[model samples]
Target: MLAAAALAIAGVAYSSWIFDFIVPTGQDRFRSFLSELEADDVPWHQVYSYGDIVAGVAAVGASLLLFGVRPAGRGATTAVVALGVFGTATVADALAPMGTVPIVHAATSAIAVFSLFVTMGAATWSAFREDNWPIMRTLGATTFALVAIATGWMLGSDRLQGDYLLGLAQRIQVGAMSVWLLVFSVGTWSSTRHARRPKRVPRRR
Candidate 1:
């Protein structure tokens, strides 16, 4: 279930790039944000909006599963709660369209991003404390750093040069999160699988 949710989140988040190849959105991949594809003016914008809704729902489900599977620790609890917030804010972002309600959209987007950062940071802390799944810990740290750098670049591009890199930066940020989620999902599945495996009894001697 968690793996499915992770896939849904990653897929919907990056599907804009796939749509770019097949659709004729008036928005530029470099200058425009992915949200532009879901704007009222764009063709099939409803699809993008629905995708966000699905992704957000999936993220929330994953958070529930995380809560169930996480080791006993406040860090793990924090991670789960933060992920739920991220998911909720993502859905709110979709509800408040960028074109119709730019201010609300921006606010929700900020909340989503901030919550994702908290989710990653707290998850990494929990992972290190557990002293297992080193790869997940590394991926969480890397994803957090990448998302921060890309988001900073996207926000600063307007002052530095232009908004040319805004879309690219946002894409990179989402991509990092997607990669981390994929790895985490797989790791979690593996752990659950191992835990469920039945131990064989040795033959009586």
Candidate 2:
């Protein structure tokens, strides 16, 4: 489970950081895409195509680890669900252009956000319930859940982006949660090592 969690976190971080380059984009794709969306000139099909391809690859990896291996069933299930949501949203977005089907895109985005929360919550629960490591694991899980809920609510309310300080705080909250997960991973590994050690024989009086 620890290994799987580590892999999932690393994969997500890497994908989030490189998603723009992973998609087919030229110079200034970011600015251009944002501008197009603001100007109502964005190509929904192209956007969905790029998103689906990237998300599909991540989904495949997550599915294999979650279902095929079965080490971390709960965490894996969360990941699979998240991937499914993304996949569905991508297809919906592609079929229904934002201009022609604004509601569809809006709904898909909302579902996607909900799925992300579910994924993180599941991961935190998985770590928390592992009896081998309690304190750090539980603390990490609690902190993550609280922050996830708080930030999610703020973002959903559309207040975080409007307030620079709130946005910065949200980022800090997430970053702290990520660090906690990393710490929990290390604690898990240490516990595993201790569990695998041979019992010491009692000394003769």
- lDDT tens digits by residue: candidate 1, 1-205: 5544574565456344456658777677777778788778788888778877877777788787767776558877887788789888988998998888999999999898889889778778877896534556776577778878888888787568644587788778777776766666665666666667999999998
lDDT of 1: 0.74
Top model number, TM-score: 1
For model 1, the stretches where C-alpha displacement exceeds 4 angstroms are 1-17, 159-164, 199-205
Kindly provide the TM-score of model 2 when superposed on the true structure, using C-alpha atoms: 0.48
CA lDDT, every model vs. true structure: 0.74, 0.48
State the lDDT of candidate 2 residue by residue for 1-205, as single tens digits: 5443543453344233223346533425322322123123433334434443454344444445444544345564664466456545544544554566778766865564466456556555555663434434567566666667656654554543443344344444434544543554454456557667999999999
TM-score of 1: 0.85
